[model samples]
Target: MNEQQENKPLISLQNVTKTYGEKTVVDDLSLDISEGEFVTILGESGCGKSTLLKIINGLITPESGSVSVNGQKIATPAPAESKLVKLRRDIGYAVQGSVLFPHLDVAQNIGFVLTLDKKSKPEIAEAVERARKIAGVEKELLTRLPGQLSGGQAQRVGIARSIAARPKLLLMDEPFGAVDEITRRSLQDELSRIVKQEALTCLFVTHDTAEALKLGSKVLILKTGKIEQYDTPEKITQQPATPYVNTLVNR
Candidate 1:
């Protein structure tokens, strides 16, 4: 309890629920995520972790309840003005199999968001270059089309592009899914370093327990639309809340 009180939560979900037809993917779900924290939502294929992320980002609306960020009540599909606009500007979302413009290369993809922000040409160029540097994107790769880039390279491009917006919260769904094991490990380490250095508040969703344990400061096991367990990675492993959680970690 004392340990839980340490970080100041930046987002809180209260009595959040979502339903599709007869199925309840997330039911009366609630959570609190601290500022500058990395919280991973782990579950099986049909669980609502991914959907929850979309809801938080206002890509999807909940059937009931509220999602608040930094004490402001977030309207569903948030208004595209002022703080909401700025909040949208500050939150980054990344996904596996993320679509990249076939016509665009690394530099172009990273520059797209900057262009939308009405930044100066030099500012856009500088941001694009910095993002590329942070993602370890090669100068040569910047010239190559997305089709020419490998899976790992494409993923890095996606990461660089997402961060270029300077989002305060990052929502990632299986961002390492397409990469090979070696590249996945390298990317994971790099991401952890980047998130820590930037004081990013991140919500990552993965079906893999290893991935959850490796990346999450807090790991929440969601069963359908509900959180079955929420704890530190070590605590979740050492003292699972249910037989299913133990089985998952053990497996």
Candidate 2:
């Protein structure tokens, strides 16, 4: 384990549960994530992977239990906009696909968060450059609009934007799911490098077992809104906690 693992958890969920129209999406989930740790969440469809991420980000409030991030308790049942915005200032959320604004150019899109945070032009420029460099984005693409770029390029820009503000926690939902195999591999490598370099704690949600095994310091497997197993990739592969986990590893 890295030194960061020895530190206190930056995110904590205690008996968290989320229900939508009588359907429980996340049921009594408790998790702790250490600072700088990369945790990948894996599950089949309707297993509540995305709901878990949203709960942590305070985007979706749980019906029961509590959540805290960086030692601050997030209001459950309903989070105030001001509090959510303040909490999210330290979090970067990258949805499944490339979600860049079509009207904004690459540089504009990457610097959008900083702009929202009321950063000066010079600071935004410096941050944008550093983020783009870390994300492996070429300088030539900075001025291009999102519609002009390929899926892979748009995804990279989205990642760059997520990191541009130097958020402590990053939430990525299938960031590489829309691209070709080659492009996905490249993005995966880039994400690993950036995460390590920045020492950013990440919660990545994906359906790809291989991806979950490759990039996560700890892999969390969910089955029907419940935790099937949560452990290191090596441990999960060698000694799965349940039959579902065993089948997932072998499959």
**Considering every candidate listed, which one attains the maximal TM-score?**
2
lDDT of 1 by residue, 1-251 (tens): 47655565678898988899999988998888888889998999989888988887766678888888776677554555576656676555333336678998778887887887899999988988888888788888888889999988898888888777666788888788877999999888888987887677888889989999999999989997888899999999999899989999976
**In the order shown, what is each candidate's alpha-carbon RMSD?**
2.9, 2.2
> What lDDT is obtained when candidate 1 is compared to the true structure?
0.82
Q: What 10-residue stretch in candidate 1 is worst by lDDT?
A: 89-98
**What's the TM-score of every candidate structure?**
0.91, 0.94
Worst 10 residues of 2 by lDDT: 89-98
How many backbone clashes does every candidate have?
4, 0
Candidate 2: tens digits of C-alpha lDDT, residues 1-251? 67665777889999998889989989999999988899999999889999998888788888899999888888465768886886677554434335888999999999998898899999999999999998878999999999999988898899999888888888988778889999998889989998899988999999999999999999999998999999999999999999899999976
| Model 2 regions lying over 4 Å from their true place | 1-5, 90-97
Tell me the deviation in Å of residue 199 in model 2.
0.3
TM-score of 1: 0.91
